[model samples]
Target: MDGVLVHEERAIPGAAEFIAALRRHERPFLVLTNNSIFTPRDLRARLHAAGLDIPQESIWTSALATAKFLSEQRPEGTAYVIGEAGLTTALHDVGYVMTTRDPEYVVLGETRTYSFEAITKAIQLIESGARFIATNPDPTGPSPSGSLPATGSVAALITKATGVEPYFVGKPNPLMMRTALNRIEAHSETTVMIGDRMDTDVLSGLEAGLRSILVLTGSTAPGQVERFPFRPTRVVDSIADVVPLVTELAEGDADGA
Candidate 1:
């Protein structure tokens, strides 16, 4: 969502028009993000502020996917989480109990601040047999100044301390795309994954059996596409290039083609 629709909280060119076209055509799509720092409502507000009129239900985050996975794997389970309201609220909504004492899982997610005490506790918990889980595998996140240490970096520290590797539940992991597909009742055959990063987004989509489109608006440059052994179904300059495809798909659907 950050790169495809907006870059640094500013709407990318044609992003708003693309969303409008989708809505006008009655197309079902979700704005996906690996960031687990904010809830869907929070993301919706941010998108709206950037001039994109996306609903809360149309935004999906790694936090939501992690919570759903935990709830289904172990209903009413307990977790010791180190993250923001997004991760905590999702787990709570899924009837999860959060506690530091003997929790079933130690869930790690993205946050602006990383607490040393919390990291120590998480390591201890993992050492004590609590399973480890992380929202995303992004090692660093973007900031105005520079890149900041993200969940993956901390997860690596915890793993080194406890010899337990965390199971990540965000992009690059096909489970993330599959879970999103389940939420929208979308089929791999008909779904198209549009992303700015070939490593995570395109890889996930390709592994999930969906067509992938790579946009050069962020992360990936035109020259880098060929460096990857695999390629997206199509490579476009930006989201602007894909807007017409939305109209074409809508027309085809209308004609039962």
Candidate 2:
């Protein structure tokens, strides 16, 4: 949602209108993000501040996904977590106890301020036999100054210390995409993923057997498309271009009705 629907906290051209169209048509949709620091409620507030009216419940975050994965695989397990409210709250919601003693998993996630002490504890926990997991594979995230080290970079540090590779639970992983689809009860055959990154969004959508559309408002550029082995089903200038298509589809649905 950050890049596709809103870029740098501002609604990209036509993004708000497109979302309104979705609501008018009664189309189910979700705003997705790999950043696991903020809860869905926080994300909804952020989007609202940016002039994008996505609901709190419509936000699907990596923190939520990781929590779901843990609950299904190892219910009520203890975890040593290094992240912010989003990750911690989700784990708690799923009945995961946050602990540093004999944890079943050491979960890594994105945060504005990553504490060295927490990272050290994570490394120590993994060394002591806790399975390692990460929220996303993004090594760096954009900031007002420049790039800042994210979960993946910190996860690398833990791996180097403990010799244990962390399993990532976010975008570019088809499991993440499948969970998002399942949350909305949307069929991959009929759903189309709109994203800006080729590596994360496009690749994951393609892998999930969903149609993918690449928008230029975020990370990927038109020149970079040929560099990737796979391509999105469609490419558009921005969400602005998608508005018309959505209107047409809605009209067609009405006509059929």
Candidate 3:
């Protein structure tokens, strides 16, 4: 329920009701987000503000997965970040030394205060043999007002300046999905990815061998699906429809029993 969960500061219509229904049924689900701006705690608070009473552990952000990956790859390296506080903090928590001058790795994510100077610094670092890493390659993110350019835009600028592509660590890349699934203890076959965007959310699920459900309430429109190469297993008008579908599936299984 990416876009259907929260559009900017406000929760989408029926989102809270749907989540309440999930809680009522004791069904397991998580808010798996590719946005790296918020930590789990921050996300939990935001959801609470939006009237979605979800636990912190149920909120997984790409920043957390990126930090986990970096910790395993390079335990102690200076990182030059071009992201929000959450991404920076996640890297620091994973034993990485955050630095701007002469860094070992150049990590890029979303930053509201982006500048050409910052992009230039990232390019110089990348050109100086520093490993370039990106949290996610999402080109745009949804807001209540409209869509805004996301981390991928920054990554593109850096790539254009440095002539090198950064390694992406978020959805459509499988690592983030694997981490979330591992944390939830859910098998690929039993899990379904519900999100608004087709390129990241749906494609990521398909790549991870899980079922994908696209909702029309986010970045993707119903008409665009027919032209897309990777089709989701199912499509719905909104996340509100998901609970009923699951109920139907459960009832069918009961009838079979």
RMSD of each: 0.9, 1.4, 1.8
Q: Which candidate is the best by TM-score?
A: 1
Residue ranges of candidate 2 with Cα displaced over 4 Å: 254-257
- TM-scores for candidates 1 onward, in order: 0.98, 0.96, 0.93
Q: What's the best-to-worst order under lDDT?
A: 1, 2, 3
Model 2, 147-182: lDDT tens per residue? Answer: 899988998988888889999999989999999999
lDDT (Cα, tens digit) per residue for candidate 1, span 1-257 = 97899999999999999999998988899999999999999999999999999999999999999999999999999999999999999999999999999999999999999999999999999989999999998888877788899999999999998889999999989898998998899999999999999889999999999999999998888999999999999999989999999999989988999
User: 1 or 3: which has the higher lDDT?
Assistant: 1
lDDT of each: 0.94, 0.91, 0.85
Report backbone clashes per prediction.
Answer: 0, 0, 0
User: Total clashes, candidate 3?
Assistant: 0
Most lDDT-accurate candidate = 1
Candidate 3, residues 199-246, lDDT tens digits: the string is 888889999999988989888888888888889998999878887877
**Least well predicted 10-residue stretch by lDDT in candidate 2:** 1-10
